[model samples]
Target: MRNFVVSFVIIFLGFTLAIVYHNNNKNNMVKAFAITLSLLKPTDDKSVILINSTIISDFFKKYPDLKKYKSDVSALYKNRNYKSIWYDRKGVIEFASLLYSKANLLNEEGIESNLAYKDKIDGIFGKKSTDKLSPTDTELQLSSLYIFYSKKVFQGIDTKKIRETGWFLPRKNLSYKNLLDSLLINPQLLSKNEKQLFGQYYKLREALKKYRLIEKNGDWNPITTDLLPKEYKLGDSSKTIGQIRQRLAVIGDLKQNSKSNLYDKELMAGVLNYKKRNSMKMDYSINSMLIQRMNTPIEKHIKAIIVNMERCRWIAPEMTKADEYIIINVPSFKLIFKRNSKKELDSDVFVGETMNETVIISSNVTQIVFSPYWNVPNSIIENELIPAISREKNYLEAHNMEWKNGKIRQKPGKKNALGLVKFIFPNADGIYLHDTPSKSLFQSEYRAYSHGCINMSKAKELALLLLKDNPDWPIERIDNAMKGEKETVCILKKKIPIHIVYFTAWANDSGEISFYNDVYERDSRLAELLISDDSK
Candidate 1:
């Protein structure tokens, strides 16, 4: 009887265990079926639906217009495990709304690219409720919108296009996926601390708006004057003087118009300010050339501002992060050495002329050669030297030049074309910054006269500043090296980055706007690329 009871208990317990296992498996199958149904069919709570590659594929297939952004869209979704990035249980997220607004008003950012499917996005927002929302469609549209915004604001023109425009400066590498991740975490990134674009771009954008406003108000009247006087100085009186006062006041150079025909002390101050800003000789006397520049149409200034904004876009924000760097603005004919984000040295420079325009690039200054030899470029030897030698036998001797190793090089002296010292940032173009024999050229307002290299007016000062910390090269030694006939090369302890840029329009930290002459006529070429109607 005891054996029978034990067997009966064991069989009943085994049967109960099998029933519970079967029921658990059945419940799991039912739950899986419900999940598959939710994915296949739209659910009441959109967040419950699983976002997968198939849904994204179907979304793209339905909206073939956004096929151009396939790679960007794919990468964005793949990074998030095919989850809906722009949408949530409530509706489209805050960033979507902000991005849409920014895209619609791209002009405010000085961008010309048209946003794709902008009207469709508007219609989606126009709808009062999320009842008609298609999750897949919404996701794709937002993805496309993000790409459009990135291209215009962050990427600027394509790399190939910028190179074609003659901009060889190091292009900024932008990671839109990372930017999106940050935006997802904090939508306020769009408005604050957008470090992707260079800081100068924002400053130029603000100036652009102000200039556009001036244009909208029928622009200031052009200053018309007779060829009455050779020079207009302080205390001069004429009808033209009154027009100058009005022009200066309109452009914020003068405190008030005063409506007086006399060129008094206040007007003199305004004229000096204007001259300082416009790269003109900082004197009280006004000349016809200065007046002509002042009379440039507001439309042309607006165009210049737009062109420079494009340039600012190409510059990487990271370039400015360096503790020390050198910047040479070609159009401005100015070189600035910055340390710890402040101007350590600023000097007037001579750049290449229109035919031999200086290349826009960035490199590291590794060495400074004092009493440097001027290695005459083959092009120069063929074009100028050979012809000059033919005309005059003593040409080489007079210029202190000699032929060596099948190439012509000027001996290191006061008459050497490369001047007393040269800063070498080895590049393919054979360009460097050096001192010039003709110091008088620095006094001129227009100083674009070089053979693809930069000539610094204060070369000695720059050398001293660069070697200030080095015990091996003191100021006395630097002066002796520059004055000595023997060429001396000194390698820098730390390589300083040098950036050569061409900008016709720029705004200072104080919001003062300055316009420069397009010495190489590159503004129009760049403007054509930026403003052209072709869609990328």
Candidate 2:
């Protein structure tokens, strides 16, 4: 009886302990589950709402058409700790609506394509219907739309295609995740954030609108010269002059069209203005070429503006933020030097000929060589030099060239092909900026005369300005160095950024647009890629 009582008591104690342990374990599990659920839910701060990542994965699976943006969407959500950015306690956020509107009007941004899942996206904001998506579906759809819109408007086309277009300048790398965060805080940035885009983009967009309006309002008739003189100048009278006057007036080159046939002083002023805008010599003469330029249809002009705007999309606004830089527009045959955001110099430049096209690139002007020797490229040697030598044995001696290390190099002198000075910016293509002995070429309206390197008309002036801040070099020394007696090299203490760009259309600060001839026939090719839905 004693042994039985002891065994029963021990069993009872063991059973009580087991029950306590089980209850404690269940309570701990319940507490842990409650904490995890809290983490997955919206916190006291409305902006800190969390979301289940599984929903995002499911969303992409259902909408495979929008899967292109799935990675970007996932990164955006993960950046906010799996938060729902496109939504709040309300069904949809105001910025989401703004983004949807932007996506709808991609045409205004020079984009011609329908967004992915357009019908589903439209249904999100449309009137109530059976096709209305769930709250989660609506949120994911809006996020995908925002990515599409940003890629089209801010980023232009893909990098691979842009590189294929022959634009090698550094492209903009924007973080849309952070961009969205800022937009959510201050939605005004959605419209006023010019910093996010190249400044020229906005200018070109305004020009596009103006040209489209002109096309819509019955474009001006083409000027005909069938029975008129080949050229029209001041005091020249013809029916063609009346047509020219009307043409100039249509594009704001002339304040008003006089409706008179005689070419009067007003018409001469208009002609000069027209010539200036078209990158022609600012003179009172109008010829077949000027008339041909004027004959370009409004549709072509709109396409050119759109093409340039697309090019602008590839550039970043921060590129121009440097303290000093040089912008060489190959089509315009002009070089713009800016320091502290002010135009320091505007000089004439001649780029490469058609067969040897100048490459669009960016680099730093590292050194300036005075009285530099011309190391003729191997292609030129093989093509021209060997043949010239075969024709005349005295060709090399007469040109002050000699075989150095089995390669031909012209001695530094007045007769040197690369005139008195050369600005060296290291590049793989072996191209640089230098003065040319052929000063007469700069006088020509079309200055595509170089082999590949740029020939600056004001090379000496540029050297002086670039070295002005350096105490080691001054105006007197620079002039002495250009006398062509021997080679003198000056490595710049501070390198200046130089960008050789190809822009056939540009808008001035006054919003007046100027058009240049497509020197390399790049506009049409780029335009085709820009407009093609497949390229996008």
Best by TM-score: 2
At residue 400, candidate 1 shows an lDDT of 93
Best of the candidates, lDDT: 2
Clashes of 1: 0
How well is each residue in 47-163 modelled by candidate 2, as lDDT tens digits?
533356888899899988888899898888888777677777655767778887777777777678777768888887784446878777877888888888777777788888787
Query: At residue 423, what lDDT does model 2 achieve?
Result: 96
Model 1 spans with C-alpha error above 4 angstroms: 1-50, 127-133, 192-194, 533-536
Question: TM-scores, in order shown?
Answer: 0.89, 0.90
Give the worst 10-residue stretch by lDDT in candidate 2. Answer: 41-50
lDDT over C-alpha atoms for residue 200 of model 2:
92
- RMSD for all candidates, in order, please: 7.8, 8.3
Off by over 4 Å in 2: 1-50, 127-130, 533-536
**Taking the tens digit of each residue's C-alpha lDDT, what string does model 1 give over 434-535?**
999999999998888988899999888888888988999988888888884899999999999999998899899888899999898887887788877335
Indicate the residue-level lDDT of 343 in model 1. 90
- Per-model CA lDDT versus the true structure: 0.82, 0.84
